[model samples]
Target: MNQVLTQKPHDMLAATLSNEMAAVNTLIQTRMASEHAPRIPEVTAHLVEAGGKRLRPMLTLATARLCGYSGDNHVKLAATVEFIHTATLLHDDVVDESGQRRGRPTANLLWDNKSSVLVGDYLFARSFQLMVETGSLRVLDILANASATIAEGEVLQMTAASDLATDEAIYLQVVRGKTAALFSAATQAGGVIAGAPETQVDALFAYGDALGVAFQIADDLLDYQGDSTATGKNVGDDFRERKLTLPVIKAVAQATAEERAFWMRTIEKGRQDEGDLNHALALMDKYDTLSATRRDAMEWVTKAQDALTALPNDPIRQMLHDLADYVVARLA
Candidate 1:
């Protein structure tokens, strides 16, 4: 059997789009500064300087280039996408009550939730200001809707997180709102900014939506199986948090009465023992939900790749396709 080598899609994207990415980073630094409040810059810089793949902004830059855009607004738009993403992370860490992010102390932990929340609001405001500079109502609409959708997804997850009744459809809805909304908006706005044809623009949206779904599913799956060092997350973190991610949802769907009782005790009641994580993994293994979840992630990846078929046959398009595959390949 041939062992498949895992490819680094974001590295390829960064290498190819280095110039535009540099412009985006510069703009990010410029906009994140606040003269009225030094603390705002401090909080923003802490998270921004932390090494993230900048995948969302790269998607904006790459899609704009793929559509043959030669204008300057794409850089601003790319920065806008990144600010929104970073802001979301700030808010998410606060909500998750997490101590670590990107293997560093979370901003909320270092400073306070108030700082993280206010700074996140500031970033969101800056993102809106930057998007408005594009002078495209369509771009504003798409990004605004995505921001709202992301908030709604977070709220939905709040209600659904520990509920055993949460189904796969509800899970996908949450994924689409929280993760895929920004991705689809990123690509869609890029195409719109470039004045690409409607078909190509829609194709870009589809590709992004599918790619985001695949990415989130892979991340959720990794919470159970990934190396803590490599993933910057402890295994079974979601289980411990009672997030009701896909694998656990699958396992819950097929859970026997006794297994369901265990889930109810641990997840619904907020009581967990040291052995609970191992037992959850054992149940998942018994049900083979991990493999089933991996299959679902691959299906989304294929959907993402298929959506790229409508795009131009170019290196950018090929990179996008490979990116979709590499999302799931992290699981392998």
Candidate 2:
């Protein structure tokens, strides 16, 4: 068998789109520079140059190309998508008080919270400028709504964190807002910029939404049972953070009266002790919530694959389909 054939779907997609991705990187570097405020570039470079997968922006580039876009505007949109993502990451690190990102000290940790916030604001302004340059009202509208939705989702997650009442429906809402909104916007804007038909645009939106949901759910699942090395965090990190992810939600929903008190003490009140993580995992195992969460992630994967049926039968499309499968392949 060819070695390339055995590579992961995203790695393959990255290789296939290497030239375009290089262009996106160049554009990102160009736009992230600062003429007046050197700290803007310094803060931005700390996070942007970090070795992230760049999966979100790549979605924009791949979707535009899959829709037969041959214009340079897609490049701008790809950079816009990345700027928005990085800005959110900077803000998120502040909110989460995270010390590390991509296995390095977070920008907020290296600099200060003030610099991260201001630099993130600068990036958001830059993203809007890039989108406006495209001169497409619909593209602007899509990205603008996504930006608002991202903020709203973060607020929702903050308010809902550790609340026992936070169920699967609320979880889905948060996921759509924080993760899927940008994803759908990235793909939908790509199709719109390419002047793809309405049906194809809708399909692209659906594909991105489902893929984002699947990706997030898989990430949540991995937080419980994944390898510390591969996942870049110790297992049960979510439990420690008091996050009511799907598995914990499922377990909470099925908790006995005694189990409810346990959740109330540890999750709602944040009085976790040394054995709390083990107890939480035991509860999830007792209710088989991990398997249930995996099932939910797989359903989104199926929805994503179904949505791709409406797209063009290009090689990029096949990679996208495989990408959906790869998101949850770890859980398998």
Candidate 3:
């Protein structure tokens, strides 16, 4: 057989869905515009065009196409997913007090927090309008539930932040809420719009859920070990912020009493000093938590790929499987 090399899996997926994605971008631009409040578009545009991978929307389009859908509503749903994702990001940057996003200053930093918040709210309302235009109440329900879950997850993370008692189970719950909920919703809405069989829809949901968890786990791991230019944030941002992500959580689980006190002083009490991040990294290295976290991420990747077996045997299915592996491949 002739072998053909390709770009990254997401780039290949984007090439496959270029036409639909173009439509989604057009719709996003059109919907993000506000006649009276020009700042809405200004702030929204800053973040929306920040070169995000648009992976969530692509999931919607790919799943719909995989199920043999032949309608324009898929485009609408794809745009809807993007809007929801963008809205949450705007809110997140403000809440996290983040200074950077997508390798640029965050909207909250460039513009005011007020602008980011109101624009995010505007995009959210616009997202509802787009989904309603699809004429599928079920699609509306899935995205709506996802929006709620995202908010709940952010709230949960706020409460769990810097708390040494936070465990793996709580970490997973927060991950599912903040990250996986929208992923599953995007895929599930696409399948539902295509009128796919219950089994296939379930599989799509499972695949998205697992992929999202894996994606988040990889991101958390990167915080301690990744290049700043590639990750778009300084290494140890999570540690400096006192956010107890999975790698730290794993290390905490195996901490000796003295080690536990270190975590408590830095994370729980928020009294971090110079060289504290290095000390924390050394402790995680001592427990080998980074490798353990990578293993957990790989397990989720397997689950995501396994879910694809229930879907049709199409090229898109293969791309979806590759995408799952690519997410974890970042760790390498």
Candidate 4:
């Protein structure tokens, strides 16, 4: 994707967001390069150099700046969050057996799984050390709890995948675990580091949680209908992998006997050597699973906007508020 063209946004705020994201690229690069470990930079850079939105770090920096933070600690906090995120991607690639990420081979694909695992661990340790430098036990507490939640969420996803019995409640819990926890931590840490009032901190966290939920929901919906170029992953990866996402769960909620059997055969039984992909797509369309999931994502986008109403009405905060809306708009 052309990074320069990202400046084209329907709303002016998105333009600024594009620039803010670009501004953090260097900070991310410098922090990921380590002088000590011989291969640490290579592994860490493998993940970091692969372009992510850097959304987590941007959230930290934008929140701190929006809240009138004058000190430079937010930079450290932002870099810390990026490190944590990169670590998760390394571990996640190994767990998912993913060959491609950001259109490049995954760390586990380029090197051995052992190397990816070890590098991920080292990044985690480096993140902890970075947090300690801030001297804010509160920040550590928030991130430590977030780290645990992220791990538990990943475990939940692993266990839940291919489990036909998975329901809406379980899906939401999994989403919170896998995506919302880090988003909440990133924004909450911003407020905590910036010394924002507790109420504002709470508001930022609530906003982030809702935004993350909507983002994940959109992702689930797109797995069924998104352009492969835009999303980078294949259309049926989630389905083929047997992970029951929101769309499938919603469809399953109202599935008939044959549709249920179809799901069982394709998703659970893994008997998809035949043309099950077409059958699964037809079933998803018949049930309007894509539409239903998209609606859920939109609802959360509204809820996310509502959460931001309590924040001070400033350009930055309002942009963030708009950002929540922007996240799901593309999927629409």
Q: Which of 2 and 3 is ahead in lDDT?
A: 3
Clashes of each: 0, 0, 0, 0
List candidate 4 segments past 4 Å from native.
1-27
For candidate 1, what is the TM-score? 0.98
lDDT of 1 by residue, 279-305 (tens): 999999999999999999999999888
- CA RMSD for every model? 1.5, 1.6, 1.7, 3.1
TM-score of each: 0.98, 0.97, 0.98, 0.92
Off by over 4 Å in 2: 1-5
- Give lDDT per model, in order: 0.92, 0.91, 0.92, 0.81
Give the distance in Å from residue 75's predicted Cα in candidate 4 to where it truly belongs: 0.9
- In candidate 1, which residue ranges exceed 4 Å CA deviation? 1-7
RMSD of 2: 1.6
What is residue 262's positional error in candidate 4, in angstroms?
Answer: 1.5
Candidate 3 clashes: the total is 0
